[model samples]
Target: MKTKAVRLYGKSDLRLEEFELPEITDDEMLAKVVSDSLCMSSYKAALQGGDHKRVPDNVAENPVIIGHEFCGEVVKAGKNVAHLAKPGDKFTVQPAMFYKGSLEAPGYSYPFYGGDATYIIIPSEAFETDCFLKYDGEAFYHGSLAEPMSCIAGGAHVNYHTKFGSYVHEMGIKEGGKMALLAGVGPMGLGTIDYALHASRKPALLVVTDIDPVRLARAEALFTIEEAKKQGVELHYVNTAEKDEAYVMELSGGTGYDDVYVMAPVKPVVEMGDNILGMDGCLNFFAGPTNTEFKAEFNFYDVHYAATHVCSNSGGNTQDMREVLKMMGEGRLEPSVMITHVGGLNCVPEVTLKLHDIPGGKKLIYTQIDMPLTAIDDFAELGKTDAMFAELAKIVERSNGLWSAEAERYLLKNAKPIG
Candidate 1:
């Protein structure tokens, strides 16, 4: 089968090219990718190329497709798994296939098995690891976001210890506990907010901190204070650049935070999160830095005296993805809140190259269409010049400016690549 994709060859080398997909064995499956989301990790991988830990040594010879967060429809099923794979079945995958103690994740390590392509073969290991999942969400983008959301879910579900020798452990964020997302309202932090708001173990107070006013405003627009009040969640969006640590501490009524997530990789931010932890507070370092020698200041005093422990999770497992899908299906979680822009397959290469510089949340890509990576807010402006964009603007407006499945369908049906 012929497919188009953005492949990674080496550092600063990403190419959008057409190639013939190798035939899958009886133990494999092929899927037509519908939606893939750009991530900061992909940007790192693009820059690191062959040096990336997950990237294979043969990437120079056999370039790898360059996305991990995506969803697709099953187009072909191998004889070994024909019964489980219906031709038109929609699904998302947990890309972190920890096969036989190996750290080889798809979208970085596997050839012909990543998510950037229009079609990809689900390798035998993926099936054996049960990475593929049935998706019943409203939009394909929801399926695409399942991976990142699953990572947040995994962090939320990490068990905590009060003492080293203690046999008992605490599960999730404490029920009705105070939580703070330091350097929050970024793409992944938004998913954590969604989960914190709607998960069964709800937070009584959620303080979202960010230095950027634009990001804080966007986050407030998505999750309004009024809605938080309705749900009985005392929410505060603070611009930390302007506010002092004392002001932030007062937001939680002086008890400090029960849970603090260091969402940024900056050293000061990480250290700041460390100092704000309450007794038995669990600080989760959520952002994974690309540099191997990346170090941050930590307060060992908190660990010894205050019983505050630190934890970090790289990615979620298959069970985490399943929980995220279940939450989405139940209408309790809206992972699509992570998306701020949409584009077609052709947008992949450009978006991958400029992912970090892009000023917005996650960028959603439709693998079948050929359109520019246009921000949802820009549809109104583009509509003034082009008739097709005008139609898309109406679709977006109908959904209150959020990128919806209906809008996506309209864009795919009418929009064309910018000439």
Candidate 2:
């Protein structure tokens, strides 16, 4: 069967092309992709291309599909895994697959099976590795977001405890304790905020710091202090560049944060988060750095005397995706807040190329639809000019500028089919 996909050939080379999909064997499964979210990791992959660790060596001659966070419907399942995932099953798979002790993952390593295509082959390894999750959500986009949301959940799951004269480690943040998200108003940071707010063991005081006052202002608007207070959270948004050290110290009641997350990979931000650690404080290096030799300063005195420690999580596993999915299913967490724009598969190349330059949250690509990428906030303005977009704006506006199941239905109902 022929399918359209965005494939990467090498550095700075991404193409939207049509190719024949190979038949699935008994150990594989075929799925029709619905939604895929563009991620920063994909942006980096595009720049690195063949040099990327997970990119297969033959990518230049045989291009590979390039999206990871996605959800789809099972079209055909091989007999080996048909019992686990059958036809018509709506599902999302954890892209962080380590098959047979290899670092290969979907998007970066697989040739025909990635999120940016209309159909994908789920290798037997995916099923054997326990990366597939059955999704019964209101919208397919939510299933795609479960992957990134799970990454945030993974950070919160990292935990540490010290035994008598020894050390111990655990997953998860300090429950119901003080926490700080530094440089935390960006896309991933926003996801962290959503997860932090609705986490089972919520924080008593959640302080979010950003260098940009504008970004901090936007964060305040999204995660309103009133809402946080109602949820038993004392939330604070601070422009760390402007706010003095004394002010932040005062907010933490003289001690420092119990858990400090450095959302940016910058050196200064990492040091800043380290500096504000309270006794037995845990600093989470949540953001990944692209540079091979990225360095940050830490006070060894505090690490030894005050028991300050550090932890880092690259990505979430299958269990983390399951947790985030359940939270979304229960309505305790809303993953849609991360989505700011939506588009069709054809626009994947453009969107992926200028992803960082774009000033919005998650950009969702609908593989089956041929619509241009439209920002949710722009729908209202577009409604004033274009009738069709205006119709879309109404559904989105009714949901308070947030994408909802009704909005998804409306778009699918009105979208022009791929020709």
Candidate 3:
């Protein structure tokens, strides 16, 4: 099969090209990628190229495709995996296939098994590690979003607290305890809020803080206080630009929070999370810093006396991905809240290379289409000239400015096909 993909040849060298895919072995499968969500990790991989741990050292000579968070349909299932999947089966992958402790993963390490292509050969390691998951959701974008949402789910799951006497560690965030998300208005932070509000285990009082009023306002509008109240969660959106740590403490009733999630890699944000932890509190540093020397201060005094601790996670395991997919399929979680931009496969090179400069949430790409990276917020303005944007504007406006299954269907049906 022939595939169009964005490949990384070296540091800051990403190219969009078409190439023939080798025939799938009996241990492998064939898939047609439909939707992929751009991640900051992909940008980092492009920046470091072969230097990135997951990227191969010979990447300059053997370029690898550059995307991991993706979803698609099975075009052909090899005999060995036929029992697990079949033709036309919708699927998403857990790209972190830590097969035998190797750093190699799908997007950064594999030439024929990344998300940025129209077609790919599923490697045998994915099946061996049970990372090849079947997604039954109606929208391909939801399947694409499952991987990211699982990271949030994994973050929550990995948090642990200890009792005063026993040596046992209690896993997960403290249920019915106070929780805070610092600098939490970005895409991953938004997903964290969604999971916190709707997941089986939840905090009684949920506080989200951000420096940007525009982002905080948008977050409030999307995950309304009214909706949180129905779920028995007291939700608060605090603009830290005007308020101080004292103001945040007032909301927690003078006592510190039981769970504090640091959403940004900023030093101040990490220190703020550390300063507000109650006894036996678990602080989850959810952001992944690009710098190897990234450091933040924590009160060791509290750690020694109050039993406070810290933990971090880069991506979710297979079980976390399954939970996210289950929640999405049950209509309990709306991962679409993370998406801010949409484009086609043709735009993947530029978008992936300069992703950090482009401000917004997730940038979703449809592999078979040919369109520039366009913001959903700009749909109405673009609608004045294009009839397709006009209809999309109406569809999203009715859904309160969020992307939807309806919009994906419309775009795939109307947008120009990738040539």
Candidate 4:
């Protein structure tokens, strides 16, 4: 089979090319990628190339396809894995398959198994590790989003707290306790808020802070306080640009927060999260810093006296991905809020290389189409000259300006096919 994909040749060297895919062995299956959500980690991999731990050292000679968070349909199921995956089965993969303790993963390490392609061969290691997940969700984008959402879920699950004089640590955020998300108006932060409100372990008070008022407004509009109140959560969105930590502490009744999450890699954001910890407060440094020497100051006095602690997770495990899929299927989690831009396979190389400079949540790509990267908010403006964008603008407008399964279907049916 022939596949079109964006491959990384070296540092910042990405090319979208069409190549013949080797026939899958009996131990492998083939899939047609439908939707892939671009991630910051992919940008890091492109920048570091072979230097990235998950990226192989021979990328300059043997380039690997880019993109990890993807969902697709099975085109052909090999005999060995036919029972597990049949032709036409919709699926998503947990790309962090720590197969046999190797850091090699699908998007970063595999030449024929990444998400930024029209077709891919699923290797045996994916099924062996049980990372090949069958998705029953209606939208392929939902399945693609399950990977990132799982990371948020895993972050919440990894937080730990202690009881007085007890050596044992309790997993998960403090239930019915005050929780704060610092610099939390980004895409991942939005997912974190969605999971926190819908997950079984609910926080009594949730405060999300960001320096950007525009982002804060958008977040508030997406996740309204009235809706949070129905879920028994006292939710507040604050622009930290104008207010300081004292103002946030006041919202928590001056007792400080029980669970504080720092969503930005900025040093002050980390310090802010540390300063507002209550007794047994667990600070989750959720952001992944590019710099190896990234450091932040924390109150050692609080660590010694207040029992404040810290934890973090890079990506979610298979189980966490399963939980996200379950939640998405049950209509309990809406991860579409994380997406702001949409494009096609032709745009993958440019978008993936310049992802850092792009101002948006998630950039979703349909691997079979040929369209330029465009923002959802710009649909109405672009609709003036294009009939497709006009119809899309109307569809998303009916869905409250968010991308929907309807939009996905419309785009796939009407957009130009990839060359």
Candidate 5:
């Protein structure tokens, strides 16, 4: 079969190309690429086209694929495959296969297959040990978010600060405890909320916060806060715009949110560290900042004095994928619930190019056309490099301002400080 995939040839360059299928090696299973999730990293690949380690050229010297989230049935299994693979056995793939001899993490990700195209060759590690669960659902998006979910799972294990002591926690969540889905409005952010809500047994107060009035409104409508509360998940939408620090403090009644996830873009988090997160809050930096140049400072004294610990993770590992899939199977983690917009391969470049300063949850991509995904159009391309960049800069600035306004408001509404 022919497959279309993305390759990072050089810095700031990503191109889609078609390829012929290769023979599957022993101890591997072939899977069709069904649903791939878009991440900030894809944007990085679009701009910095080359892999500094794998491909020395700024442009891709050879073809490489960019999708990681996906699931499918076994199309073909290699002769020496140890895991019993039969056709029509639907399964969810755990994107990365960390093996002894093959890991290129520091400079670039090792050849971990992704779920963005016609097919893929997976090592036995993901399935031999039962990491990739069987997917029986008719629709595809359910299991495709394994990598992202795994990251969240890992984040849960992070060591953040708390009022009493270190914010360290185990996946051994209590039956009925007070937990909050802090900054739980964006698409990825929403996924975290859905996971926490459904994954819990007795349920907790499912409070949500977002700076955007529109997104908060959308989330409320999508999943009635009250309805979830009936299932033991209380929903509270906090607009960081109105209440300020007092509002969050009031919500806790006295103590702070048990679990605070930093899901919004970067700045809100710096603001969160300074404003909310009571004496003993577990802050999960759910969304990793994209631009390194962008910096926001928080208090060192609050961290040391309050005994609050902060934790962050890049992506999910294998254990998380299994947990997310099991939750999906039983109807806990519903990724389909967070999808706001959907488009085919041809739409990726435009989606990425747009200054997403507008309020929304998540935008999903199903395909990538064969060619470079260019965000800028031809008219802007022909102009002088500096001038065109300046114009593009304008679009980004306008969007950023709108985003900031909404975010500041969100923090105030949900993140409360302790006495």
Candidate 6:
């Protein structure tokens, strides 16, 4: 059998390549990828290529599958496997897979497995047993968004209650009271918005701040702004880079935000996050700082006196994936509003290299799946335009189609015949 995967040959050297499939042991199951999404961490692994700690140096010789977020359909199961791991069932698999004996892991710990590929060999223990309710990718991406949505869900559950000042039962500190979003734009930021909008009742306002004028324009043009406004909540897009202090003050009515979450990689935003907090505001540093080596200073005087808080989250929890999915199904959230681009698995690596250039709300990497997908046409969106388009010209020039969804389904449906 054959399997095609997106490999990280070297820094900026991610490529979609083909390979032969290994025999599956009786304890293992063979699955074809139905969908996968790009994460910033994907880029990190690619930058270092196979030298990454997750993938062993040996497998690094092969392209380390760059995707950690993905879901797939079981195509084959070993004889020893039970009915529970049967074929045709959908799941958002755990990216890491270890060897039979010693904790000698292969991918991640080595390079035996990773997403951004057409197929994978999954062991029984990598994932939680509760498959049905977990981010039902079928509902969101026709089984496409299993991984991406899961990450959002994962972040939500990563210590959901991180000291939010004081806990008031009714309105104050309530589910839908007041929340702040700093630098809210792009897909990841929008995911945060969607989570805050539908999942958390903490912030009723759901203030989304961004420095990009075009992004702000597109949000309203897209669906979020109007949706947030229609819901009787405030979705304020602020320009922090230019008039940082004034805008923050104006939005809070001089009270400042109650809960602020930063969604971009910018580090200086930390200081601004501290300043924006309303009394006892719980600041969520959602965005990853550019490089771990650098440090940002916080005002000790203000921190102690005001009792402001600052914390962050990594990806999200598996349980949250279920919460996000159920919310989507119940009509409380719509990820379709944020989707702006779609492609097959083959285009993943290339598309990822140039993701910064592609303008618009969200880019959906659709696996060549037979299932239905979600899209928002009339929603204000940033479409991939031709050369004349100024906003996304650079992104257009830089984006690559490494592992495309079409390529994925092709590899899977026509899976390399097992020897």
User: Candidate 5, residues 115-222: lDDT per residue as tens digits?
Assistant: 555566676665554556667765556666666766666665553332234454444333465555656777777766666666644337656776778778767775
lDDT of 6 by residue, 121-164 (tens): 76545532333222234332534444455555554443233244
What are the lDDT figures for the candidates, one per model? 0.85, 0.87, 0.94, 0.94, 0.56, 0.56
What global local distance difference test value does model 2 have? 0.87
> lDDT tens string, model 2, 1-419?
78888999999799988889999999998999999999988988898888889897789988889999999899998888888877898999998888878888988988888999998888888888889888888799999999999899888887564544665564567777899999898878888888888878788999998888876776788889999988889999988788965687689998998899998899988888888889888999988877878998899999889989999888898989999999998988887778889999988898898987998689998898898888888887888988878988888878767888888877877888655
Task: TM-score for candidate 5, please give it.
Answer: 0.74
TM per prediction: 0.96, 0.96, 0.98, 0.99, 0.74, 0.75
**Cα displacement (Å) at residue 43, model 5:** 2.3
In the predicted model 1, the residue pairs found to clash are: none
Estimate candidate 5's alpha-carbon lDDT, on a 0 to 1 scale. Answer: 0.56
Q: Is 1 or 4 the stronger prediction by lDDT?
A: 4
Instruction: Tell me which of candidates 4 and 6 scores higher on TM-score.
Output: 4
> What is the Cα-based lDDT of residue 130 in candidate 5?
50
For residue 249, give model 1's deviation from the true position in Å: 1.3
Winner on lDDT (1 vs 2): 2
Mark the 10 consecutive residues where model 1 has the least summed lDDT: 410-419
* lDDT string, candidate 4, 293-359, tens digits: 8999999999999999999999999999989888988889998899999999999888888998999
Q: Write the per-residue lDDT of candidate 3 for residues 225-277, one digit (tens) a residue.
A: 99999999999999999999999989999889999999888999999999999
TM-score (C-alpha) between model 3 and the true structure: 0.98
Model 6 local distance difference test score: 0.56
